[model samples]
Target: MTGTAPNRPEPPLIAEPLTLPGCLKIFPKVHRDERGRLVKTVHHETYSRYGLISSFREQFYSFSRRGVLRGLHVQLPPAEQHKLVACLQGEVLDVILDLRTDSPTYGQHELVPLDGERGAMVYMPPGIAHGFYACDDSLLLYHVTTQHAPAQDAGIHWNSVGISWPDSQPVLSERDRTFPSLAEFASPFRFHPEGSPL
Candidate 1:
């Protein structure tokens, strides 16, 4: 008698230019069994093949309640980070702003609706600032190319960029509320048409 073959799972899907140059939205494949589910959020080879940063020196995560907004943040160059962000336990409205002064998309913004159950991920290139609004009690994970440096920390004011945030009064840390508006601040980052130094 012949035996039946085992099942094979499909690979994840990667959608590029989710809004800005080098930005990507990844839909990870989730395999479910009686035990639970398994997901492969990163494939180093695939990332490298697409010219996305694949080396992550640090990993961190955050938990936030609905109405909480974190960021509009980035590390200054010499320590700027390329991050892979994903929602792990709820939902969020993920946002990014292009701060590369010479790029055509500079000062532009984009939003990606992220849901933990779908396991989608966003790749944010070095010259962009990022933030998120919790749509529910949310958990977000980050794989970053550089370690955090207190002195290099910086951000643009969240409301200054004209983002249509869902909440009128978001709960914010004092620091997040204090960054200068984009127009008043001068960016040190310059867009490199060839590619960013990895």
Candidate 2:
């Protein structure tokens, strides 16, 4: 005698919410059973429904312990990357900085609480700085439109932006610790240069 297969569950829809510099893009929530849980990071159709263009070229995942701070990082023009960052395991205080001098929100900031349970994602366009502090043991998954470029990568000191970071002595890598304050470095991204692609 042959046995019938069980029906599969459908993924939840992505949610977009308001933020200071850009929208908060979210992946669908996953339901679990005795077997396991399932989640989808990107669906072209769903992203399109929200006016998101551009293809994902690379994927990255980082794990951080509580009170760990990652970055206020961004790549320069010609290597600028748009990212979709989500918390997959725990919670974080995600922050973004608007670097577009021409943008109405220039020098603005946004903070959001992201976690595995919320399944929230942040979509950061080029010309913005992004960073986060792990509020709990956290796993962050990011999808990028461009591959990593060492020379083009740049950042501002986490404390330079006037945002209050929860960790006073957060652990940081040598590279992350070496970046100059926003005012100390010459920015590589311009809002309206004569030949810019924007």
Put down candidate 1 lDDT per residue, 118-187, tens digits, no spaces.
8888988788999999999999999999999999999999999999999989999999999999998789
> Candidate 2: misplaced stretches above 4 Å?
1-11, 190-198
The Cα RMSD of model 1 versus the native structure comes to 4.0
Residue pair clashes in candidate 2: none
lDDT of 2 by residue, 12-115 (tens): 55666555434455767777788866677787876666666449888989999998899988888788977888889989999888777776677777887888
Reference-based TM-score of each model: 0.91, 0.84
The global Cα lDDT (0 to 1) of model 1 is 0.87
lDDT of 1 at 194: 74
How well does candidate 2 match the true structure, expressed as C-alpha RMSD? 6.7
- Given candidate 1, what's the lDDT at residue 50? 72
